[model samples]
Target: MPVVLLLDIDDVLVLPVGYKRGIPATLETFTRRLGWEIPLPTEADIEWFEAAGVTSEWDSTAICLAGLLLEAARLDERWIVPDFDEAMDRLAARALDGAQIRPDYVAWVKQAGEATRLGERPSQAALRLWQREVLPQLPRSEALAALLSALLATTHSLSCPTTAVFQTWMVGSRAYEEAYGRPAPVEVPQGLLEQDQPLLTRDGARALTAVWYEGRLAPAFYTSRPSRPPLKEPPPPLPVYSPEAELAARLVRLEDWPPVGLGRLFWLAEAVGLHENPTKPHLIHGMAAFAAAIASVDGIIEIQALQSAYETLQAGELKGPLAEWAEFPWHVVLVEDSVKGILGVFRTVRRLYELGMSVRLTVFGIAPHPGPKAEALEAYVDRLVPSVNDAIEEIVHLCREG
Candidate 1:
């Protein structure tokens, strides 16, 4: 049986400097513009959020901003929370700004996220809960209601200012305009995207490459990074903004591997009304990546074919033409760093079994340090490796054993 490797990009194959720094930078920009002077989330704070399944930086930014607004609505007496548009207009015009928002808001957000179970959209769910449960108690105002609605719409809409500014920081101003068909809302000379560093060593990259070429393993990128639309036949010019996963793949010389990223999932939701986010911790993302990997092994690289495979599996239909290549006695391995991602693969394996598909899943979580992430990952992952290279070695050994 050919082993399928579902690879996570950030902190597994790469350090994700762009996303890590870009998140804080996005918060800084928002705070500076609003004169809120809110403190940036610490690395530990980010780790907690990730462990709690708030993996998307866009979501993280929204959480922080919404938290501040919630706290202000409860405590700040003088200032009234404006609707999303009025706030943005004032921010753009440099009219009036507010004072510092303390760290208590983040703590409250954490509590709320935990209570709500942080579903598919953690930020939106938490905020909506706050809006419904807590907002009603706060001297009811149209502005507060409108502000809450807009904040919830951040992940829901592509035209959101927060997402636009964050993407601009990650892809740089020029690339942002090229990709989004408009000038960046925020002025940035350079993008943080290029600052991302590869974690995979040359030898490790070579080993994976060698195994891939030998037909022993089929590897594909399974990440939450934004991607261009997955089209059967792309139009005249290929997109220049290369998906974030593509950028990470290039850093580790795995550019040719199939990628099942946020863009494809988003497109699928729009096309078939599947779901808005099937990203990690959600089994759909893993199932899609598994389909893409199976397609790749059969010399089928078009994303449309991959999508067909995914749709077949999603429907639990095993006797379809699209699923002909997928068969029994499959071995799957996931290399991930986030606890939520590992749990996602675990759920995906269970789901495969429920669908009567014979598949065995082994999860390798890369947690080098002793902390919350490592401790949490230990519960779900089969093996905890110090690095992806170590995980790769184990994978090769596992392949050889059979």
Candidate 2:
């Protein structure tokens, strides 16, 4: 059997400068709206959050904004400021170290339930902690509560203000309105999405393509980015602003491959009532990526049928082509820049092994620097490389030797 490769999008194949820059922009938009300016998070601060297992930029934006509100409330409770806005003003006045923000925010998250630690629905966990701890200490003020509510609100669509603002930063104002059916509060002619640069080198692309064509490697993508709904027919033209795996694939000339993204998960939620997080380090996402990769190899071109195959795998009935995958010895290489993706695939591979499937696992972490992300990756991944190019080059060489 060919080596099955599962790749992550952000900080893996692409630099994702868009998302990295958008985090602080999202924070600034929210804080300015609340009538005070505080120190925005730096890139290192963002890395700290990712290393701590809060991978989704949406959740990161929410947590940072919520922490700001929590700080304001904390100051008000201590009589340091007369009002929330004044408290924010006081905070803005101090040269607060951005590095301290992650620790304080993480402390609040640590107080939440067990799911809070491993990139599980952390925004929701932070909300519960706030309602239980901070909400009670302050005098009842509807406006303040409403601001916090907007910060923590969840929605299937882009109705949540924080999500809406982040989308605007990502896709621009015009495209944002078209996708979500509402005018963006912020207006920019061009989106940061266009600014994202591909990280894969030419040699890496050629090596990957050669192995893929030589029947030595099977590959697919798994990511949390919202995507177009899976359809039985060929996917439609890219929307004005869709940062889906399809977009990433196009950047690397691998658009023919399949990716199991959040859009597919949203469709599953509506069709089968599968309400699991459906993102790494969650098992459902790992299984879905596995199914989609196999489907690509089996010529299962219909998106709906690929989803059905995933359901069959979940049911543990390997009656059809899924059984064929189990019969062959397979090497599964999960390539990711974050620990969550590696862990998710590890869990999925273990589940497959329990079902008597013949599969071996290798986790490759794309960590270029000695930061918190690299440190976290140390715990989960088998090898740490600087980029996907380097990882793919090594994998290709291994296939040649074998």
lDDT (10s digit) by residue, model 1, range 1-402: 668899999889999888888778987887776666656887778777776667777777777776766665565433454657665554445433354446553465466446544235776676667767777778645677677656655553545556777888987888777766777788988989889898999999888888888878878888888765577544222221247887888899989887778766666666666644567766667777877777777766456555664676567765343456546567899998887777777877777677677788888888878887788789888899889988778788666564
lDDT of 2 by residue, 110-206 (tens): 3432346443476777776677767777664444565565556562235455667787898889877776666787987888878888888777777
Candidate 2: give the clashing pairs.
Answer: none
Give stretches of model 2 more than 4 Å off: 75-120, 141-149, 153-156, 232-243, 302-314, 317-320
How many clashing residue pairs appear in each of the predictions shown? 0, 0
**Where in model 1 is the C-alpha error above 4 Å?**
75-82, 88-100, 105-109, 112-119, 232-242, 319-322
lDDT at 22, model 2? 89
Each candidate structure's TM-score, on Cα atoms with residue i matched to residue i, is: 0.89, 0.85
Best by lDDT: 1
